[model samples]
Target: MSEPLSVSERDGHCSLVLTRPARGNSLSADLVEAMHEALDSAERSGVRLLSIEGDGRNFCTGFDLAGLEATADGELLARFVRIEELLARIWAAPFTTLAVAQGRTFGAGADLFAACSVRLALPDASFSFPGAAFGLVLGTRRLARRIGEDAALSVVTSGAVIDAERAARLGLATGIVQPDELDAVKQRARRDALRLDTHTIAALRQAAGDNPIELDRDLAALVRSAARPGLVQRIIAYRAKAQDKNRTDRAAAPSTFQEGAVR
Candidate 1:
């Protein structure tokens, strides 16, 4: 099998691409670890900008559903914690981070996109977070920081797909452009990112504020929720609901990817 993720750097810009297109670029443990390594390498290399995108139809459909189903409760909670760590790392990265979202960006995928300093999406791109359905609070603080508490609450609780325009309007996306304009947007981002020295960028981000307390609070809430009795049953029910929605959607029109919760 091919690698689930790939990283390449040029002209002080690093690109991290998700490679599991056939699986809707669903994130696996190995894939997440690859991403962490890529971030480490980019930082070590003094990359001025980091760009994330997926290889094919969907940016990412979220965490691997099969992995979720097979993992024991203890292991699953650890996985969720790891995901939160990854998102936090991305959110706190010193230099500029850009996410090029396209197709179905859902759950933790949306969390990752929201974590980026700059997020661009294709006209057809759509984002949703299904974690609320399972009572997961992993990215609540970071997401609210991006789009405000009201919008964040609405999106997460409703599990409604926010299309490109709505995403930009809500500040979930910096901008939306056509597929043909993607390279130009990336170039602009790289140029602007490179114009600032690393120290200055770090200082600016520091001034923007750090939410360690909020993050800790949200994480504690997640642990509490996951530790509750019948938590596993709740996840099962959430997945069933998503599967039912997927079936209905597919009946109306063909879907290129499988649908499920993040777990």
Candidate 2:
């Protein structure tokens, strides 16, 4: 059975919610493909604004490391490129893109939020990137541009949970809203976009051009470098350890775990 992504609309805003609640809204190939399809429908529906959020405890925990354990070498390399390609679409979408993040948003999930023009977050939401632990290279160029190279390295190196306030201070989030006010916040996001002159928005989007493509190229190269035969075994081992750690952490105490499976 296919996992359902909840779709809702209010005040010119169309929201796409990741429905997998048991696995922390982790990304799998299926979820990635579903996200693309959702964006396609959003484009067709003339949604003035589009927002993506998680249905459970995490906005996204990261890629499914368990799934990646058996992923083919060819596909491992392809994943980074594909993720970046989708991000480009988000960056280039005609309407305003917003990411209303809750819980932890890591790896591709972090990049997913980065792809959005504006990100609103709850005080409890945290952000991190642990992909390096798995040799999963991220779009570092964008990361550096967003938060400066030195800070970006600190983020990747620390891989610690940074709360929403820090994320907002670092440019990763445009606003920090109370968890209870999410609906109102999302509506306000759309209204802000709606108030903007269309020509200005179009001009800015055009000015941005294909800048993300360069980052995609950079990300692809990083993936290709990491996916070379000799490197993967260590990465796989690291992920194994990390997966165990994630399980341990989650099991030790209840920490807003959600998304058993996307499908």
- Candidate 1 is scored at a TM of 0.91
- Model 2 scores a TM of 0.83
Quick one: best TM-score, which candidate?
1
lDDT of each: 0.83, 0.74
1-263: candidate 1 lDDT, tens digit per residue: 79999889999999999999887888788889999899889888989999999988888888776755566777777777777778877887878999999988998898889999999999879899988787777688788899999988889888898999999999999998888888888898999999997788877876787556755676687787677666556788888876787788777877565454343
- Against the true structure, candidate 2 has what lDDT? 0.74
User: Which number leads on lDDT?
Assistant: 1
Predict model 1's lDDT versus the native.
0.83
- Cα deviation of 55, candidate 2, in Å: 0.7
lDDT of 2 by residue, 75-179 (tens): 766765666667777877778989988887877788888778888888878888776665556766667767889988888777766889999998888889987
Every model: Cα RMSD to truth = 2.4, 3.7
lDDT of 1 at 129: 91
Q: Lowest summed lDDT over 10 consecutive residues: which window, candidate 2?
A: 254-263
